[model samples]
Target: MRAVYILPALFVAGVVALSSVYIVDERKQALVLQFGQVKQVVEEPGLGFKLPFIQEVVSYEDRILGLPTQPIEVTPADDRRLVVDAFARWRITDLVKFRQAVGAGGEEVARQRLDRIINAAIREIMGGVPSTAVLSEDRTALMNRIRDIARRESGSLGVEVIDVRLTRTDLPEQNLEATFARMRAERQREAADEIARGNEAAQRVRAAADREQVEVTSEARKNAEIVRGEADAQRNAIYAEAFGRDPEFFAFTRSLTSYERAMQSGNSSIVLSPNSEFFDYMNGVTAPVAPEVPAAGQ
Candidate 1:
Protein backbone atom coordinates (compact mmCIF):
# COMPACT_ATOMS: atom_id res chain seq x y z
CA MET A 1 0.00 0.00 0.00
CA ARG A 2 2.97 2.44 0.63
CA ALA A 3 4.55 1.71 -2.79
CA VAL A 4 1.22 2.33 -4.57
CA TYR A 5 0.76 5.67 -2.79
CA ILE A 6 4.35 6.74 -3.76
CA LEU A 7 3.60 6.02 -7.46
CA PRO A 8 0.36 8.14 -7.28
CA ALA A 9 2.24 11.17 -5.78
CA LEU A 10 4.96 10.85 -8.45
CA PHE A 11 2.28 10.83 -11.15
CA VAL A 12 0.70 14.02 -9.76
CA ALA A 13 4.08 15.75 -9.66
CA GLY A 14 4.72 14.65 -13.24
CA VAL A 15 1.40 16.26 -14.31
CA VAL A 16 2.41 19.55 -12.64
CA ALA A 17 5.82 19.44 -14.29
CA LEU A 18 4.13 18.86 -17.64
CA SER A 19 2.01 22.00 -17.14
CA SER A 20 5.12 24.29 -16.98
CA VAL A 21 7.03 25.09 -20.20
CA TYR A 22 9.95 27.21 -21.38
CA ILE A 23 11.70 27.83 -24.70
CA VAL A 24 14.96 29.47 -25.89
CA ASP A 25 15.98 30.64 -29.33
CA GLU A 26 18.65 32.91 -30.72
CA ARG A 27 16.62 35.19 -33.03
CA LYS A 28 13.39 35.71 -31.12
CA GLN A 29 11.95 37.59 -28.16
CA ALA A 30 9.32 36.00 -25.93
CA LEU A 31 6.42 37.86 -24.33
CA VAL A 32 4.43 36.22 -21.54
CA LEU A 33 0.81 37.29 -21.11
CA GLN A 34 -1.44 36.16 -18.28
CA PHE A 35 -5.19 36.38 -18.85
CA GLY A 36 -4.88 38.75 -21.87
CA GLN A 37 -2.49 41.04 -19.97
CA VAL A 38 1.25 41.53 -20.25
CA LYS A 39 3.02 39.54 -17.57
CA GLN A 40 6.66 39.83 -18.69
CA VAL A 41 8.94 40.33 -21.69
CA VAL A 42 12.10 38.26 -22.24
CA GLU A 43 14.60 39.42 -24.86
CA GLU A 44 17.67 37.40 -23.94
CA PRO A 45 18.66 34.36 -25.95
CA GLY A 46 18.27 31.57 -23.40
CA LEU A 47 15.68 29.32 -21.82
CA GLY A 48 12.95 31.18 -19.95
CA PHE A 49 10.03 29.93 -17.90
CA LYS A 50 6.31 30.53 -18.36
CA LEU A 51 3.28 29.23 -16.57
CA PRO A 52 1.79 26.85 -19.11
CA PHE A 53 -1.97 27.04 -19.78
CA ILE A 54 -2.13 30.12 -17.52
CA GLN A 55 0.57 32.45 -18.95
CA GLU A 56 0.72 32.37 -22.74
CA VAL A 57 4.05 33.06 -24.44
CA VAL A 58 4.13 34.86 -27.76
CA SER A 59 7.36 34.87 -29.73
CA TYR A 60 8.47 37.81 -31.91
CA GLU A 61 11.37 37.89 -34.32
CA ASP A 62 14.61 39.78 -33.62
CA ARG A 63 16.29 39.38 -37.01
CA ILE A 64 16.73 42.11 -39.56
CA LEU A 65 13.77 41.89 -41.90
CA GLY A 66 12.78 43.51 -45.16
CA LEU A 67 10.12 46.18 -45.08
CA PRO A 68 7.86 46.32 -48.11
CA THR A 69 8.60 48.90 -50.79
CA GLN A 70 5.91 51.39 -51.79
CA PRO A 71 5.75 53.46 -54.93
CA ILE A 72 5.30 57.16 -54.27
CA GLU A 73 5.38 60.14 -56.62
CA VAL A 74 6.20 63.62 -55.42
CA THR A 75 7.25 66.84 -57.08
CA PRO A 76 10.64 68.29 -56.31
CA ALA A 77 11.32 71.95 -55.66
CA ASP A 78 11.47 72.50 -59.40
CA ASP A 79 7.99 71.03 -59.79
CA ARG A 80 9.22 67.95 -61.62
CA ARG A 81 7.33 64.80 -60.73
CA LEU A 82 9.37 61.82 -59.67
CA VAL A 83 8.09 58.29 -59.09
CA VAL A 84 10.03 57.10 -56.07
CA ASP A 85 10.21 53.38 -55.28
CA ALA A 86 11.72 52.62 -51.91
CA PHE A 87 12.14 49.96 -49.21
CA ALA A 88 13.83 49.53 -45.83
CA ARG A 89 15.15 47.00 -43.33
CA TRP A 90 13.93 46.86 -39.72
CA ARG A 91 13.53 44.71 -36.58
CA ILE A 92 11.50 44.94 -33.42
CA THR A 93 13.08 46.98 -30.69
CA ASP A 94 10.63 47.36 -27.79
CA LEU A 95 7.90 44.72 -27.79
CA VAL A 96 5.63 46.96 -25.79
CA LYS A 97 5.63 49.82 -28.34
CA PHE A 98 5.33 47.25 -31.13
CA ARG A 99 2.26 45.66 -29.51
CA GLN A 100 0.66 49.01 -28.84
CA ALA A 101 1.10 50.67 -32.24
CA VAL A 102 1.19 47.46 -34.30
CA GLY A 103 -0.66 44.41 -33.00
CA ALA A 104 0.88 40.99 -32.67
CA GLY A 105 2.38 39.70 -35.96
CA GLY A 106 1.32 42.90 -37.67
CA GLU A 107 4.29 43.19 -40.04
CA GLU A 108 2.11 44.72 -42.76
CA VAL A 109 0.88 47.40 -40.42
CA ALA A 110 4.42 48.11 -39.34
CA ARG A 111 5.46 48.30 -42.96
CA GLN A 112 2.68 50.85 -43.53
CA ARG A 113 4.06 52.96 -40.73
CA LEU A 114 7.49 52.68 -42.23
CA ASP A 115 6.21 53.86 -45.63
CA ARG A 116 4.63 56.89 -44.01
CA ILE A 117 7.86 57.78 -42.25
CA ILE A 118 9.97 57.20 -45.37
CA ASN A 119 7.58 59.23 -47.49
CA ALA A 120 7.60 62.15 -45.12
CA ALA A 121 11.38 62.22 -45.24
CA ILE A 122 11.36 61.91 -48.98
CA ARG A 123 8.85 64.73 -49.38
CA GLU A 124 10.79 66.94 -47.03
CA ILE A 125 14.09 66.33 -48.76
CA MET A 126 12.59 66.41 -52.22
CA GLY A 127 10.92 69.70 -51.44
CA GLY A 128 14.28 71.30 -50.60
CA VAL A 129 16.64 69.78 -53.21
CA PRO A 130 16.81 70.68 -56.89
CA SER A 131 15.42 68.37 -59.52
CA THR A 132 18.81 67.89 -61.13
CA ALA A 133 20.26 66.84 -57.79
CA VAL A 134 17.44 64.43 -57.12
CA LEU A 135 17.60 63.02 -60.61
CA SER A 136 21.34 62.72 -60.88
CA GLU A 137 24.24 64.42 -59.15
CA ASP A 138 23.43 64.65 -55.42
CA ARG A 139 21.31 61.50 -55.14
CA THR A 140 23.67 59.90 -52.63
CA ALA A 141 23.45 62.80 -50.20
CA LEU A 142 19.69 62.87 -50.59
CA MET A 143 19.54 59.14 -49.83
CA ASN A 144 21.56 59.61 -46.66
CA ARG A 145 19.24 62.35 -45.48
CA ILE A 146 16.25 60.14 -46.21
CA ARG A 147 17.79 57.24 -44.27
CA ASP A 148 18.43 59.42 -41.25
CA ILE A 149 14.88 60.73 -41.23
CA ALA A 150 13.36 57.28 -41.71
CA ARG A 151 15.40 55.85 -38.82
CA ARG A 152 14.36 58.68 -36.54
CA GLU A 153 10.68 58.28 -37.42
CA SER A 154 10.82 54.48 -37.26
CA GLY A 155 11.46 54.40 -33.51
CA SER A 156 7.71 54.23 -32.79
CA LEU A 157 7.60 50.83 -34.51
CA GLY A 158 9.90 49.37 -31.84
CA VAL A 159 12.48 48.57 -34.50
CA GLU A 160 15.81 49.81 -35.71
CA VAL A 161 15.89 51.01 -39.32
CA ILE A 162 18.92 49.23 -40.68
CA ASP A 163 18.88 50.98 -44.07
CA VAL A 164 16.67 52.92 -46.40
CA ARG A 165 17.05 52.64 -50.17
CA LEU A 166 15.50 53.99 -53.32
CA THR A 167 14.82 51.24 -55.79
CA ARG A 168 13.95 53.53 -58.72
CA THR A 169 12.79 56.97 -59.73
CA ASP A 170 11.19 57.46 -63.09
CA LEU A 171 9.16 60.05 -64.88
CA PRO A 172 5.64 59.18 -65.94
CA GLU A 173 5.28 57.17 -69.11
CA GLN A 174 3.52 60.08 -70.78
CA ASN A 175 6.58 62.27 -70.14
CA LEU A 176 8.99 59.53 -71.23
CA GLU A 177 8.45 60.19 -74.95
CA ALA A 178 9.39 63.85 -74.61
CA THR A 179 12.55 63.02 -72.67
CA PHE A 180 13.57 60.45 -75.25
CA ALA A 181 13.07 62.96 -78.06
CA ARG A 182 15.18 65.55 -76.26
CA MET A 183 17.95 63.01 -75.66
CA ARG A 184 17.87 62.00 -79.30
CA ALA A 185 18.10 65.61 -80.43
CA GLU A 186 21.06 66.23 -78.14
CA ARG A 187 22.84 63.16 -79.51
CA GLN A 188 22.23 64.27 -83.09
CA ARG A 189 23.70 67.69 -82.37
CA GLU A 190 26.79 66.08 -80.86
CA ALA A 191 27.19 63.82 -83.88
CA ALA A 192 26.86 66.76 -86.26
CA ASP A 193 29.56 68.65 -84.38
CA GLU A 194 31.85 65.62 -84.57
CA ILE A 195 31.28 65.29 -88.33
CA ALA A 196 32.01 68.97 -88.89
CA ARG A 197 35.26 68.65 -86.96
CA GLY A 198 36.24 65.62 -89.03
CA ASN A 199 35.53 67.49 -92.26
CA GLU A 200 37.60 70.48 -91.17
CA ALA A 201 40.52 68.20 -90.22
CA ALA A 202 40.29 66.37 -93.53
CA GLN A 203 40.34 69.66 -95.48
CA ARG A 204 43.40 70.83 -93.57
CA VAL A 205 45.19 67.53 -94.28
CA ARG A 206 44.32 67.70 -97.99
CA ALA A 207 45.57 71.28 -98.33
CA ALA A 208 48.81 70.37 -96.57
CA ALA A 209 49.31 67.37 -98.86
CA ASP A 210 48.65 69.49 -101.97
CA ARG A 211 51.21 72.07 -100.86
CA GLU A 212 53.78 69.30 -100.28
CA GLN A 213 53.15 67.87 -103.74
CA VAL A 214 53.68 71.29 -105.41
CA GLU A 215 56.96 71.80 -103.54
CA VAL A 216 58.18 68.31 -104.48
CA THR A 217 57.41 68.85 -108.18
CA SER A 218 59.19 72.21 -108.19
CA GLU A 219 62.27 70.65 -106.60
CA ALA A 220 62.31 67.81 -109.16
CA ARG A 221 62.16 70.28 -112.09
CA LYS A 222 65.03 72.29 -110.58
CA ASN A 223 67.11 69.11 -110.18
CA ALA A 224 66.44 68.13 -113.82
CA GLU A 225 67.56 71.59 -115.07
CA ILE A 226 70.77 71.34 -113.04
CA VAL A 227 71.57 67.90 -114.50
CA ARG A 228 70.97 69.12 -118.07
CA GLY A 229 73.28 72.12 -117.57
CA GLU A 230 76.01 69.90 -116.09
CA ALA A 231 75.76 67.51 -119.06
CA ASP A 232 76.14 70.43 -121.56
CA ALA A 233 79.24 71.69 -119.71
CA GLN A 234 80.77 68.16 -119.76
CA ARG A 235 80.15 67.84 -123.49
CA ASN A 236 81.83 71.19 -124.12
CA ALA A 237 84.85 70.12 -122.01
CA ILE A 238 85.13 66.78 -123.93
CA TYR A 239 84.90 68.62 -127.23
CA ALA A 240 87.73 70.98 -126.22
CA GLU A 241 89.91 68.00 -125.16
CA ALA A 242 89.38 66.08 -128.47
CA PHE A 243 89.77 69.24 -130.57
CA GLY A 244 93.13 70.01 -128.91
CA ARG A 245 94.35 66.52 -129.91
CA ASP A 246 93.46 66.90 -133.69
CA PRO A 247 91.86 70.22 -134.74
CA GLU A 248 91.30 69.47 -138.48
CA PHE A 249 89.86 65.93 -138.07
CA PHE A 250 87.73 67.06 -135.07
CA ALA A 251 86.11 69.89 -137.15
CA PHE A 252 85.51 67.56 -140.11
CA THR A 253 84.04 64.78 -137.94
CA ARG A 254 81.80 67.26 -136.04
CA SER A 255 80.48 68.76 -139.32
CA LEU A 256 79.77 65.30 -140.71
CA THR A 257 78.06 64.15 -137.52
CA SER A 258 75.84 67.26 -137.58
CA TYR A 259 74.85 66.56 -141.25
CA GLU A 260 74.02 62.92 -140.41
CA ARG A 261 71.79 63.91 -137.45
CA ALA A 262 70.00 66.65 -139.49
CA MET A 263 69.29 64.20 -142.36
CA GLN A 264 68.32 61.17 -140.21
CA SER A 265 64.59 62.13 -140.05
CA GLY A 266 62.10 60.03 -142.03
CA ASN A 267 60.82 63.05 -144.04
CA SER A 268 64.13 64.60 -145.13
CA SER A 269 62.95 66.79 -148.09
CA ILE A 270 65.75 69.22 -148.88
CA VAL A 271 65.97 71.27 -152.06
CA LEU A 272 69.79 71.77 -151.74
CA SER A 273 72.19 70.46 -154.46
CA PRO A 274 74.31 67.41 -153.64
CA ASN A 275 77.45 69.59 -153.63
CA SER A 276 75.87 71.99 -151.12
CA GLU A 277 77.38 72.30 -147.57
CA PHE A 278 74.86 69.71 -146.23
CA PHE A 279 75.78 66.98 -148.81
CA ASP A 280 79.49 67.83 -149.04
CA TYR A 281 80.15 64.78 -146.91
CA MET A 282 78.58 62.45 -149.49
CA ASN A 283 81.02 63.74 -152.15
CA GLY A 284 84.08 63.78 -149.83
CA VAL A 285 83.63 60.44 -148.02
CA THR A 286 83.90 58.03 -151.10
CA ALA A 287 83.24 57.64 -154.84
CA PRO A 288 79.84 56.36 -155.88
CA VAL A 289 79.53 52.60 -156.28
CA ALA A 290 81.23 51.71 -159.62
CA PRO A 291 78.88 50.71 -162.38
CA GLU A 292 78.45 47.01 -162.49
CA VAL A 293 81.81 45.81 -164.00
CA PRO A 294 81.76 43.97 -167.32
CA ALA A 295 82.33 40.31 -167.06
CA ALA A 296 86.01 39.72 -166.16
CA GLY A 297 88.31 39.23 -169.18
CA GLN A 298 85.41 39.91 -171.62
Candidate 2:
Protein backbone atom coordinates (compact mmCIF):
# COMPACT_ATOMS: atom_id res chain seq x y z
CA MET A 1 0.00 0.00 0.00
CA ARG A 2 2.94 2.50 0.61
CA ALA A 3 4.62 1.70 -2.72
CA VAL A 4 1.35 2.21 -4.54
CA TYR A 5 0.85 5.72 -3.01
CA ILE A 6 4.46 6.75 -3.77
CA LEU A 7 4.10 5.74 -7.43
CA PRO A 8 0.89 7.78 -7.79
CA ALA A 9 2.57 10.85 -6.18
CA LEU A 10 5.60 10.60 -8.50
CA PHE A 11 3.31 10.51 -11.56
CA VAL A 12 1.46 13.61 -10.38
CA ALA A 13 4.77 15.46 -9.80
CA GLY A 14 6.03 14.48 -13.22
CA VAL A 15 2.86 15.81 -14.84
CA VAL A 16 3.13 19.11 -12.92
CA ALA A 17 6.80 19.51 -13.78
CA LEU A 18 6.16 18.98 -17.49
CA SER A 19 3.35 21.55 -17.44
CA SER A 20 5.52 24.20 -15.69
CA VAL A 21 8.50 23.84 -18.02
CA TYR A 22 8.72 25.42 -21.52
CA ILE A 23 11.52 25.74 -24.07
CA VAL A 24 12.07 29.12 -25.85
CA ASP A 25 13.70 28.96 -29.23
CA GLU A 26 16.56 31.33 -30.02
CA ARG A 27 14.58 33.01 -32.79
CA LYS A 28 11.47 33.53 -30.72
CA GLN A 29 10.27 35.42 -27.66
CA ALA A 30 7.56 34.33 -25.27
CA LEU A 31 4.92 35.73 -22.96
CA VAL A 32 3.63 34.12 -19.77
CA LEU A 33 -0.12 34.59 -19.52
CA GLN A 34 -2.34 33.96 -16.50
CA PHE A 35 -6.11 34.09 -16.85
CA GLY A 36 -5.80 35.77 -20.29
CA GLN A 37 -3.56 38.53 -18.86
CA VAL A 38 0.19 38.88 -19.46
CA LYS A 39 2.06 37.84 -16.32
CA GLN A 40 5.69 37.81 -17.50
CA VAL A 41 7.69 38.50 -20.68
CA VAL A 42 10.50 36.22 -21.88
CA GLU A 43 12.73 37.77 -24.58
CA GLU A 44 15.88 35.64 -24.23
CA PRO A 45 15.88 32.06 -25.35
CA GLY A 46 16.06 29.42 -22.56
CA LEU A 47 14.00 27.18 -20.33
CA GLY A 48 11.20 29.03 -18.54
CA PHE A 49 8.71 28.09 -15.76
CA LYS A 50 5.07 28.86 -15.13
CA LEU A 51 2.43 27.88 -12.55
CA PRO A 52 1.12 24.44 -13.36
CA PHE A 53 -2.38 24.09 -14.86
CA ILE A 54 -3.11 27.87 -14.62
CA GLN A 55 -0.46 29.76 -16.68
CA GLU A 56 0.51 29.23 -20.35
CA VAL A 57 3.17 30.58 -22.73
CA VAL A 58 2.73 32.34 -26.04
CA SER A 59 5.68 32.55 -28.48
CA TYR A 60 6.46 35.26 -31.01
CA GLU A 61 9.29 35.70 -33.49
CA ASP A 62 12.09 37.73 -31.98
CA ARG A 63 13.96 38.30 -35.22
CA ILE A 64 13.09 40.76 -37.92
CA LEU A 65 9.92 39.91 -39.80
CA GLY A 66 8.57 40.77 -43.22
CA LEU A 67 5.15 42.01 -44.20
CA PRO A 68 4.41 42.25 -47.91
CA THR A 69 1.63 44.62 -48.69
CA GLN A 70 -0.84 44.04 -51.43
CA PRO A 71 -0.55 46.10 -54.56
CA ILE A 72 -2.48 49.32 -54.12
CA GLU A 73 -3.36 52.09 -56.55
CA VAL A 74 -2.11 55.56 -55.70
CA THR A 75 -2.84 58.82 -57.50
CA PRO A 76 0.12 61.18 -57.46
CA ALA A 77 0.07 64.95 -57.56
CA ASP A 78 0.19 64.75 -61.33
CA ASP A 79 -3.05 62.77 -61.24
CA ARG A 80 -1.32 59.78 -62.72
CA ARG A 81 -2.42 56.63 -61.03
CA LEU A 82 0.17 53.97 -60.34
CA VAL A 83 0.16 50.45 -58.93
CA VAL A 84 2.59 50.17 -56.02
CA ASP A 85 3.76 47.02 -54.30
CA ALA A 86 5.82 47.34 -51.16
CA PHE A 87 7.06 45.45 -48.13
CA ALA A 88 8.24 46.28 -44.63
CA ARG A 89 10.69 44.93 -42.08
CA TRP A 90 9.50 44.92 -38.51
CA ARG A 91 10.05 43.22 -35.17
CA ILE A 92 8.16 42.98 -31.94
CA THR A 93 9.93 45.14 -29.41
CA ASP A 94 7.70 44.95 -26.33
CA LEU A 95 5.97 41.66 -25.82
CA VAL A 96 3.92 43.02 -22.95
CA LYS A 97 2.51 45.85 -24.99
CA PHE A 98 2.19 43.57 -27.98
CA ARG A 99 0.03 41.13 -26.03
CA GLN A 100 -1.99 43.91 -24.47
CA ALA A 101 -2.67 45.57 -27.79
CA VAL A 102 -3.42 42.44 -29.81
CA GLY A 103 -4.68 40.32 -26.86
CA ALA A 104 -4.90 36.61 -27.69
CA GLY A 105 -4.72 37.27 -31.46
CA GLY A 106 -0.90 37.17 -31.41
CA GLU A 107 1.39 38.24 -34.26
CA GLU A 108 -1.28 37.75 -36.91
CA VAL A 109 -3.39 40.47 -35.39
CA ALA A 110 -0.43 42.77 -35.04
CA ARG A 111 0.42 42.18 -38.66
CA GLN A 112 -3.06 43.11 -39.78
CA ARG A 113 -2.88 46.35 -37.89
CA LEU A 114 0.59 47.03 -39.32
CA ASP A 115 -0.65 46.43 -42.84
CA ARG A 116 -3.29 49.07 -42.45
CA ILE A 117 -0.85 51.58 -41.04
CA ILE A 118 1.68 51.00 -43.82
CA ASN A 119 -0.89 51.29 -46.58
CA ALA A 120 -2.25 54.51 -45.18
CA ALA A 121 1.21 56.03 -44.94
CA ILE A 122 2.06 54.98 -48.46
CA ARG A 123 -0.98 56.71 -49.85
CA GLU A 124 -0.52 59.86 -47.81
CA ILE A 125 3.12 60.38 -48.78
CA MET A 126 2.92 59.15 -52.37
CA GLY A 127 -0.14 61.22 -53.14
CA GLY A 128 1.71 64.41 -52.36
CA VAL A 129 4.53 63.73 -54.84
CA PRO A 130 4.53 63.47 -58.58
CA SER A 131 4.87 60.13 -60.34
CA THR A 132 8.32 61.14 -61.56
CA ALA A 133 9.52 61.52 -58.01
CA VAL A 134 8.18 58.11 -57.10
CA LEU A 135 10.12 56.54 -59.98
CA SER A 136 13.30 58.54 -59.48
CA GLU A 137 16.17 58.26 -57.01
CA ASP A 138 14.05 60.37 -54.67
CA ARG A 139 11.96 57.26 -54.14
CA THR A 140 14.39 56.21 -51.40
CA ALA A 141 13.54 59.33 -49.44
CA LEU A 142 9.88 58.70 -49.96
CA MET A 143 10.28 55.16 -48.64
CA ASN A 144 12.09 56.52 -45.60
CA ARG A 145 9.24 58.87 -44.97
CA ILE A 146 6.84 56.01 -45.24
CA ARG A 147 8.90 53.97 -42.79
CA ASP A 148 8.92 56.83 -40.33
CA ILE A 149 5.20 57.22 -40.50
CA ALA A 150 4.67 53.52 -40.08
CA ARG A 151 7.13 53.41 -37.22
CA ARG A 152 5.29 56.15 -35.41
CA GLU A 153 1.89 54.59 -35.93
CA SER A 154 3.07 51.07 -35.12
CA GLY A 155 4.58 52.14 -31.80
CA SER A 156 1.21 51.66 -30.24
CA LEU A 157 1.32 48.04 -31.40
CA GLY A 158 4.73 47.49 -29.71
CA VAL A 159 6.55 46.83 -32.97
CA GLU A 160 9.52 48.66 -34.50
CA VAL A 161 9.58 49.21 -38.26
CA ILE A 162 13.09 48.83 -39.54
CA ASP A 163 12.53 49.79 -43.15
CA VAL A 164 9.98 50.14 -45.92
CA ARG A 165 10.62 49.67 -49.62
CA LEU A 166 8.73 50.03 -52.82
CA THR A 167 9.31 46.86 -54.73
CA ARG A 168 7.47 47.79 -57.90
CA THR A 169 5.94 51.05 -59.04
CA ASP A 170 4.38 51.22 -62.46
CA LEU A 171 1.63 52.74 -64.49
CA PRO A 172 -1.69 51.03 -64.51
CA GLU A 173 -2.10 48.57 -67.34
CA GLN A 174 -4.85 50.65 -68.89
CA ASN A 175 -2.57 53.68 -69.13
CA LEU A 176 0.63 52.02 -70.36
CA GLU A 177 -0.21 52.11 -74.07
CA ALA A 178 -1.25 55.74 -74.07
CA THR A 179 1.87 56.88 -72.25
CA PHE A 180 4.16 54.94 -74.59
CA ALA A 181 2.44 56.37 -77.67
CA ARG A 182 2.86 59.91 -76.40
CA MET A 183 6.53 59.32 -75.67
CA ARG A 184 7.16 57.86 -79.11
CA ALA A 185 5.49 60.79 -80.83
CA GLU A 186 7.52 63.28 -78.87
CA ARG A 187 10.75 61.48 -79.76
CA GLN A 188 9.82 61.30 -83.45
CA ARG A 189 9.10 65.01 -83.56
CA GLU A 190 12.47 65.73 -82.02
CA ALA A 191 14.18 63.44 -84.50
CA ALA A 192 12.51 65.21 -87.41
CA ASP A 193 13.66 68.58 -86.13
CA GLU A 194 17.22 67.25 -85.85
CA ILE A 195 17.09 65.90 -89.40
CA ALA A 196 15.85 69.21 -90.78
CA ARG A 197 18.61 71.10 -89.03
CA GLY A 198 21.21 68.66 -90.33
CA ASN A 199 19.94 69.07 -93.88
CA GLU A 200 20.09 72.86 -93.62
CA ALA A 201 23.67 72.71 -92.35
CA ALA A 202 24.72 70.34 -95.14
CA GLN A 203 23.19 72.64 -97.76
CA ARG A 204 25.09 75.61 -96.39
CA VAL A 205 28.37 73.70 -96.58
CA ARG A 206 27.71 72.54 -100.15
CA ALA A 207 26.88 76.07 -101.26
CA ALA A 208 30.12 77.37 -99.80
CA ALA A 209 32.13 74.67 -101.57
CA ASP A 210 30.50 75.33 -104.95
CA ARG A 211 31.06 79.08 -104.68
CA GLU A 212 34.71 78.52 -103.85
CA GLN A 213 35.16 76.21 -106.81
CA VAL A 214 33.65 78.77 -109.19
CA GLU A 215 35.81 81.58 -107.84
CA VAL A 216 38.97 79.45 -108.13
CA THR A 217 38.17 78.40 -111.69
CA SER A 218 37.42 81.95 -112.80
CA GLU A 219 40.63 83.32 -111.28
CA ALA A 220 42.72 80.57 -112.92
CA ARG A 221 41.24 81.32 -116.33
CA LYS A 222 41.87 85.04 -115.95
CA ASN A 223 45.52 84.46 -115.01
CA ALA A 224 45.99 82.08 -117.97
CA GLU A 225 44.64 84.68 -120.41
CA ILE A 226 47.00 87.35 -119.00
CA VAL A 227 49.98 85.01 -119.47
CA ARG A 228 48.95 84.17 -123.04
CA GLY A 229 48.66 87.87 -123.95
CA GLU A 230 52.11 88.64 -122.50
CA ALA A 231 53.64 85.74 -124.51
CA ASP A 232 52.09 87.02 -127.76
CA ALA A 233 53.47 90.54 -127.19
CA GLN A 234 56.96 89.16 -126.49
CA ARG A 235 56.89 87.13 -129.72
CA ASN A 236 55.88 90.22 -131.73
CA ALA A 237 58.75 92.21 -130.22
CA ILE A 238 61.27 89.48 -131.17
CA TYR A 239 59.99 89.41 -134.72
CA ALA A 240 60.32 93.19 -135.04
CA GLU A 241 63.91 93.09 -133.70
CA ALA A 242 64.94 90.44 -136.24
CA PHE A 243 63.41 92.46 -139.09
CA GLY A 244 65.13 95.70 -138.03
CA ARG A 245 68.54 93.97 -137.92
CA ASP A 246 68.34 92.67 -141.54
CA PRO A 247 65.35 93.52 -143.77
CA GLU A 248 66.48 91.44 -146.76
CA PHE A 249 67.16 88.36 -144.61
CA PHE A 250 63.84 88.69 -142.87
CA ALA A 251 62.08 88.96 -146.26
CA PHE A 252 63.91 85.87 -147.47
CA THR A 253 62.93 83.92 -144.33
CA ARG A 254 59.31 85.10 -144.70
CA SER A 255 59.28 83.95 -148.32
CA LEU A 256 60.61 80.51 -147.30
CA THR A 257 57.99 80.16 -144.57
CA SER A 258 55.18 81.06 -147.01
CA TYR A 259 56.39 78.52 -149.58
CA GLU A 260 56.58 75.71 -146.95
CA ARG A 261 53.03 76.46 -145.68
CA ALA A 262 51.56 76.52 -149.17
CA MET A 263 53.14 73.18 -150.10
CA GLN A 264 52.76 71.42 -146.71
CA SER A 265 49.75 69.42 -148.01
CA GLY A 266 50.88 66.12 -149.60
CA ASN A 267 48.52 66.82 -152.50
CA SER A 268 49.41 70.31 -153.75
CA SER A 269 47.94 72.01 -156.85
CA ILE A 270 49.88 75.28 -157.28
CA VAL A 271 47.81 77.62 -159.42
CA LEU A 272 50.03 80.75 -158.76
CA SER A 273 52.15 82.60 -161.33
CA PRO A 274 55.76 81.53 -161.62
CA ASN A 275 56.86 84.98 -160.38
CA SER A 276 54.73 84.86 -157.25
CA GLU A 277 56.59 86.11 -154.16
CA PHE A 278 55.70 82.86 -152.32
CA PHE A 279 57.87 80.92 -154.74
CA ASP A 280 60.74 83.39 -154.81
CA TYR A 281 62.93 81.37 -152.42
CA MET A 282 62.22 78.09 -154.27
CA ASN A 283 62.89 79.65 -157.68
CA GLY A 284 66.30 81.07 -156.60
CA VAL A 285 65.67 84.05 -159.03
CA THR A 286 65.31 86.64 -156.23
CA ALA A 287 68.65 85.64 -154.63
CA PRO A 288 71.01 88.62 -154.03
CA VAL A 289 74.82 88.31 -154.72
CA ALA A 290 77.29 90.38 -152.62
CA PRO A 291 80.01 92.51 -154.47
CA GLU A 292 83.65 91.37 -153.93
CA VAL A 293 85.81 93.69 -151.74
CA PRO A 294 89.68 94.22 -152.32
CA ALA A 295 92.13 92.59 -149.88
CA ALA A 296 93.74 94.90 -147.26
CA GLY A 297 97.31 94.48 -148.69
CA GLN A 298 96.20 95.72 -152.15
Candidate 2 Cα misplacement greater than 4 A, ranges: 1-15, 100-105, 248-298
- Clashing residue pair totals per candidate (backbone < 3 A): 1, 0
lDDT of each: 0.78, 0.87
TM-score, predicted candidate 2 vs. hidden true structure: 0.77
- Residues 205-255, candidate 2: write the lDDT tens digits: 999999999999999999999999999999989978987998678777766
Q: For residue 182, give model 2's deviation from the true position in Å.
A: 2.9
* Residues 250-276, model 1: lDDT tens digits: 767766565555556554444556665
Clashing pairs in 2: none
| Candidate 2 whole-model C-alpha lDDT, 0 to 1 | 0.87
